[model samples]
Target: MRDYDEITAFLGEWGPYQKSVFFFLSLSVFPNGFCGLSIVFVGDIPEHRCFIPGNLNLSEAWMNRTIPLEQDKDKLQYSKCRRYRLDVIKNLSEIFPDPDSVNISEVGQEPCLDGWVYSKEQYISTIVSEWDLVCNNEWKGPFAMSIFFIGVLTGSFISGQLSDRFGRKLILYGTMGVQSVFSVLQIFSPNWELFCLLNFFVGLGQISNYVAAFVLGSELLGKSTRAIFGILGVCISFAIGYMTLPFVAYFIRNWRILLFTLSLSGLIYIPMWWFVPESPRWLLVKGKAKEAEAIFRHIAKKNGVTPPEVFFTDLELEDLKAKSKQSSTIIDLFKSPNIRAITIVNFLLWMIITSIYNGLSLNTSNLHGDDYLNCFFAGAIEVPAYIASWIFIQRFPRRLSLTGILFLGGVVFFFIQLIPSNLSIIATVLVMIGKFAVSCALAMVYVYTVELYPTIVRNMGIGTSTMASRLGSIISPYIFYLGIYYEFLPFILIGCVLILAASLVLLLPETINIPLPEMIDQMQKFKFISRRDHMNLDPLYTHAATEEDNTVTQKTEEI
Candidate 1:
């Protein structure tokens, strides 16, 4: 029986239908880039000090001096959390008409009971300022971010199963609705607690829709298109979305308005349900051969080509049905030694990549520069990283590309610590470079992990890997907090982690110029199969769209 690609060759690789699917799907991912990392601005904590109420009847200079100056690193700055005893200050103001005459240093300090005053120079309003998530409650800001990621974790865990059970299009649009509706609800959030709760659903919808789009695109597009869609198309669209955050956040300084604006973008994708069809590959795997063939015929019609009346051979349809009935679960990922090794390595790599990526992205506020510009630079850097990743995946082996970029990222991170503290620009450049490399590695890891799993459990494997990454994201805010102990601690920690992750990449087998495995055993067999042997034994091995694909139309079916 002919393979799916062989049977579907009449539709053409870059047909009119494929182009539309690619365009719509890539556009759909644009929101994910910004929505995933909006916390940079949404949860921004600007320069703040105790709010000295006007009822205290204090002079301007004494009022300004109400908050005690505390030693921060090498310089003295106004304390963010503490202020001099208000009653004592009021009494002192009566005794010493001249504020300079009093011993301000001797005054005792207390927490800001009246609440805190946040600077509006950067943000007109953020969750931090709106909720007074400063001082003792400052941890709440990070906790809010973590709650969103926890929602991502939940989404990642269940999205695959949901997608597999329901059709991809159903889950894709359903989660898109989930993301859009909940995000709008957050605009009416009366308290931080409610906002965090709504944010969980936002995160749930966010990653679920993203993963759905990813899987749907992978299944809908042809072999070559899959790689490009996964690497350049989806990733670059996300990066573009990410870059928009700084621009939008720069204009709308209020977090609520910014979120409302970003959340509404998901609604634009509602029309995609009519344009994008269910994944034919998924339908075939689910034993809906007739439904899959109807989609193929529709694509052919759109592309102005006539498909064969008999789209799939009876034997091919039977093969699909047999495979469909053989269900695989998460337990199967660990049932075999080789598959288990792949699963474990994937989990660790995804965790490290996600934690480090999120750590670097989230810490932009701490970098020595303007937060908006820093964020813009952070998002802008991803474009080239993704472009470079596309080129690497096209030219180099998966393992080499992932390991090389990760090593380069790790080394650059280490150099960041060695830079002079005075050269903030140099340090910032290094951080961007580190972001570039890690961002590239992230793209590579996504493609690599996809290729590592067989079709039977591909969604499960990707979902579990994504779940592991959320664990990393859950702790990433704390990783950035490590900077409080030492300025370079986050970078130092990321560097060490990336170096180790790079070393681990060597253990996994490469998947370049190889057909996607159809079963878990086929993936495990990769370790023992030489490249030349792969081509000789499996005619479909050159599924990367080589010239051989034109002539090798039919081959013996085996796994």
Candidate 2:
């Protein structure tokens, strides 16, 4: 058993190749958020109407009052609308001076409705009722977000049961296959209701990338690499937004075409699937002793090492004693000690995170788009956050560093409220700071949750947590819908929710530099540490690389 544990420890010690695969895979899942933002890219900014019945030249006031809104109907009815219309024509370039302005902004939104503009939709009634195909906004707005996250929540919860019954790798492949099909379908949806429905189904399939990818990676790796891989996986997954967002913002004229084209990138994994090993731990639990042994032997042989036959025999001896008590079902999770608490906290953290992440990304409308230039600049800021978090994560303990990141996100979001768009430089800086902190918070929460759970209920815990995360996701669109009505509403709500999430994190124990928490009780054994020494992993982490992981690295190195 000791040797088996020793050999099992370093199964993926070579490098970050598997981490790389996971990172790339994460992109297929998260780019939907980026796409959500870009959905409003070519649409018009809406103008508010006061509906007063006096002598004010509504058109003149509209043109010279602020920025010219893409659509203005409520102001058109004013009795003195003539003089107001003339001033707008004089400065047409700045405020719809020419006839072609509407044609130019009509990229994805077709037909060019004569009196409508695009903006956020924080109201549920408006999102469900008003902004369908009759409007250029389409059904793919907040409702699409709700549908996608619903799929994520359900997939996250169910993937655990599937893995528990079958195995990890199989479930992973199955989920990805389904997600690819649905993602492609989402792009071509023609109507508002149909598009919303397709987005819901697509979200369902895409979320599988999250649940299965993380568990599959964690099962194959040693503890030392797990946290790093987990965090990096999330960052790289989202970074696709930086590259893809710019491309979509620039070249992809139609939203559906961009989605369909991006869907093809997922196929890159099909060939790579030849190498990902199934979870030996899961096999062991199923009493597939010979199968587990063969895997172990193969790993040992590949590492220039050998597993003694005794290790296999000992691991196979089912602890009949432990087995006699009760068969461990997924349901045992709800009733377990301390695990229930962890599950609740984990779920809430994901919810708050997904809410803010998806919400803010879609809020790109509020950001500048004089050209696609802003998209590139906004996306570029993510890299620095990744590097900064990379340096601090393994060094700083999860509690303080993670809380700081989340709190920082909330602080930046809060400041965004104070700084108006007119103060362009300050607003831009604040947005960058907010994005950086939120990204770090997102990476830490996902990695930390994975580390806190034990192997027995690992998948279940993650799935349940993601379910809560999905709930947060569902609410994001509604919040965004409200922001459309009241410009700062969503930002204010997201900032406050994020602050609550940051506070909630402090209640959970830290898991850096500590041994992998096996049973729930071991979680109570946490100790705080200084920032500098966080990356020093335990000896168990570098045992020996498994054949599956080692095989891929050797081939890559040779090539």
Candidate 3:
């Protein structure tokens, strides 16, 4: 029986048909980039102070003096949550006949009873300013972001199963609609509670849409183009979308308007439904050989080639169906000692990479620099990181590259606290450097995990790793919250975790220029074979192992 790769080879690699699918599918990933990180601007906390009631008859000096002064490190600023007793100040001014003579420091203070006044210089409005989510309510800002990630966590688990049961195209369009609709509704949210509830559903659709596009592109594109399009193409598109957020937010300062604009961007993808097609490989596995053959002919016509009279024979279709019918459970992942160890290590590495990557992205606001520029730099840095990751994977050992990047990121985080407060620019640069390293590590671990797992349980392994990554994302926002108690606590914790994760990576075997394992038993026997030895292996023996492995790997890619 002929394989799908052979069929794709006949269709043509990187031809007009494949290029069109790759372009449109990459476009679908744009919205996810902004939607995931919109909270950095929407939940921003601007400079603010307690509002002084206008009814009190007082000079400008007394009015300004009503709010007590406090020291944030070396800089002195007005207290955000507290103010001096206005009535006591009024009486004291009358008795002393001078405002300056009465020491404001000795007077008692109280929380803002008349509400707070937010600064409009940086942001005209934000979720924090509009809802007074500062002071005791500050935790809610990160909580909302965490809620969004919780939805992503839930979506990651079920999207694969749904796409398998239905079809990739249907799920892609359906989830895109769901995500776009819920994101628009977020603008009309009456309160934070309602906004979080809607945000959860939006999260569910967000990752689901991304996964569908990713899998569909993998199945439709040719092998020569699949690695580039699946790994770098979608990521570069996402980075472009992410880089647009700071510029968009800079012009549209109002949080509601910014969200409305970001959410409306999803509408641009609505036209893609007509241009994209379902995976022909999936159709053949579902026993619809006729439908698969029709797509093949359409692709051949688009590529200006003629299709064979009998493209997919009945026996080949039956074999594809039989392979698809084979079932594997989660328990299978833990049945073997070597596979189990690899699974545990990969999960930990994913969790660490995700936590640091997202934690740095979300914490861009805390860095000592312009928030918009910091955010833009954060997004912009990843473009090169992705490119560098592609190069590193091609030229270096997977384990060494992964470990080196993680260690580099961890060291930067550890020393970030040592920078002098007066040199804020130096500190910001360090944070950006750390962002760059973690971004590369993030990209590397994804491909590395796929190479490590056997084809039989590849999808299961990646799915479980993604779930752990989402769990890390859920904890990331809260990591920034730790800064409130201790200025350097978050950095210290992230640094320690990353370094430990890097050390654990040394335990996994290298998989550079090696034939991917087809079974858990093969994976157990896998070792660090050099390129010279790998080349000397018998051609027939290597071909037999690789043939089955490639088929299973291709199917795994579609998930």
Query: What TM-score fits each model?
Result: 0.91, 0.71, 0.93
Q: lDDT of each structure?
A: 0.85, 0.59, 0.84
Candidate 3, residue 19: how far the Cα is off, in Å: 0.9
User: What is the per-residue lDDT of model 1 for residues 67-150, given as tens digits with 9 covering 90 to 100?
Assistant: 888888778999999999999999999999888998898988889999988898878898899999987898898899899999
Q: Rank the candidates by TM-score, best first.
A: 3, 1, 2
lDDT of 3: 0.84
RMSD (CA, Å), candidate 1 to true, equals: 5.1
Runs of candidate 2 exceeding 4 Å displacement = 9-12, 15-140, 297-311, 320-343, 370-373, 451-458, 513-516, 525-559
Error of 2 at 138 (Å): 7.0
Each model's backbone clash number: 0, 13, 0
Per-residue accuracy of model 2 over 1-559 as CA lDDT, tens digit each: 3433464754456444444445544544454435434444423233222222224334553434322234332223312111223333345435554445544322222232223332333211222233433233433555666776787777777777787788877877787777677767765555567766766666666666556666666666666666565666556555656546766546664455666666675676586566566777677667776787777677665665646755544533556223433334555455443555556677788878877776665566556444355556566666677767777776888878888888888877777768765676777677667877877777777668777776545656666776777788787766666754666666677679778988878877666655554443334322232222222133311233468544533442332
- Candidate achieving the largest TM-score: 3
